[model samples]
Target: MKILLATDAYSVIVNGVITSIKNLRRELISMGHDVKILTLSSNRHSYIDYDSNVVYLGSYDISKIYPDARFSLSYTNPLIDSILTWKPDIIHTQSEFTTFSIARKIANKLDIPIIHTYHTLYEEYTHYFSPSERIGKYLAKKFTKRIYHKSTCMVVPTLKTYKVLKKYGIDENIYIVPTGLSMDKFSIKYPKEELELLKEELNLPLKSKILISVGRIGKEKNIEELINYLTKMKFKNIHLLIVGDGPYKNTLANLIKDYNLNNKITFTGLIPNDELNIYYQMADLFVSASTSETQGLTYIESLANGTPILCRDDECLEQTVINNYNGFRYNSFDEFSEKLKLILNNNGLYKNFVENAVISVNENFSSTTFANKILEIYEKYIK
Candidate 1:
């Protein structure tokens, strides 16, 4: 199966969707299936290589770090031409962005099958725009219906998203293909000495409880609320490690200053993939308040690294981090904070969560299984 994967957001910046695509492409290639990625170009196109087969559609004067505006609005001819020339067996488009429209155009032109994956649940994004929530939801449903309805099949990360699509009258073939980090990539057999060396190198205290949150540091993530809640807490030996860089970094920094939480939190902006597991291993607990995550990969990744996760009440999250069994979940900030304190105080109970979280990831969310499921879906549609 020769697959051409298209995405709007492709950069060195840490993104779950891009990461998952790369993993899937890697696995597919490993399985002896040809796969190519088509994406809009960032500056320094020479810095990265997608082999000869991977196509760069158009080189916009876009920076690696995109601003708040939607500048990459129009699809260029080069992209259209690339799709025509390659003539893939199937086109798998990600995100409900401008690029999916291009995929739709190519599919319509070539009369080939297009598999669209609904990565981000748009209704969550609507809250950031304004106070009036109804309009945002209206636009989200309208746009979701328009884009997803055209595809031969729509792939979503969770059953929650599948249900949402059903409500929008998108009765098209919807497959649940949850994305996962390659366990082999993080499957380093660190000797006890090496593990100790890593702990020393990161300056992680042996007894200090480390909490990690990795994802886009944006308003939609509700990171500010997490920071505020942490400030109010009275944990004696706790360190908060905030990973990834985004537009809201400075805003979060200011809030940290205002709340005088500078000492408690460490902003390690965009740690490389190689060192990510070190931080994950160091963390006793992982927490994210983001209601926007379709499937929180970091939560699973942390759990896979033997760390429990705490997240807000969402269907996808609930499935991953089973409350009181694996990790914890709460309805509101107050509720979340209460649970956080309990997890922090009860040292004996922490081991159960850590063990269960790893069990959950290994049993249900392995990348190998995810890749096979995706390939099965692709084969079904393409054949």
Candidate 2:
């Protein structure tokens, strides 16, 4: 089948949604399917990368409204006429805003079905719009309903997001399809010398036990809560490595100084996606206090690299991070402190978790399986 995956976020931007799309596209191509992408160009000029099967529509920066966002001046892209000639079997939308409207327009022109994946829960990002939580959420719901109801079916990464859409009175068919990581990307064995050089460059002590968190540095991620909980713990040689950059970095940097956690924490601003696996491999544990994910690709990516997780309790992590299994979940700082000790203090248990972490990703989160599930949905919708 010829499938067209459309999104505003693509190769230039780094985040969970793009990660999921890259893996899906790679797997689908390997499975002998024709797949193409439609995304925004970084500048106000549109073009196509025939080699990568991507259509770049020109857009201007809209970061003031949302982080790393860009929107085209007009809904119609001049280059879109060429894509229409190709006539894809179906359109799969990875973003809800600009790309979504374009996808709907294309679907209408081609008379093909559109399947939208709900990658974000806008309710958690209320602060970007207004301080009033109730009003923000009300706006978020209205916006979500207006956007998603047009699609033939809606895809959510977890039941938590599914419940959110249902609560918003969205009547579209919703499927709980957890985003899959490309496991082979994390199975790499980097040279010891390279790792040592990275350690030196990042000012990481070779002997310290590393706790890494990988994602955008946004307020919604609640990274401050992790910093707060870590300060409360009376642990030894445990360093926190925050491995991404975003709007919240300045705020978090100030908070770190307030608590005097300079040596205890390190921020490696935006590591390249290809090199990200080594950070996970080098870490003793993957830690997160954020409950604001549709299904965090980092958690699965960490597990795929044989690193166990220590995260806050949420419906999203209910099945991925089982308590005392592959990882541990905490409801409070006290609970997080105890679990931190349990994982970091016990050598034998940590090894067991490392083993289970690899197994958990392989048994449940295979990218090929994810692609096949998506194909099934496309077949059902494609007339």
For each candidate, what is the lDDT? 0.76, 0.88
- Superposed model 1: Cα runs more than 4 Å off: 44-52, 61-83, 127-131, 189-207
| Top of the candidates by TM-score | 2
Residue pairs in steric clash, candidate 1?
Answer: none
TM-score of candidate 2 relative to the true fold:
0.97
What is the C-alpha lDDT profile of model 2 across 149-180, one tens digit per residue? 78899888898998998898875678878888
Error of 1 at 230 (Å): 1.8
Assess candidate 2 and give its lDDT. Answer: 0.88
Locate the minimum summed-lDDT window of 10 residues in model 1. 62-71
Tell how far residue 287 is off in model 1, in angstroms. 1.1
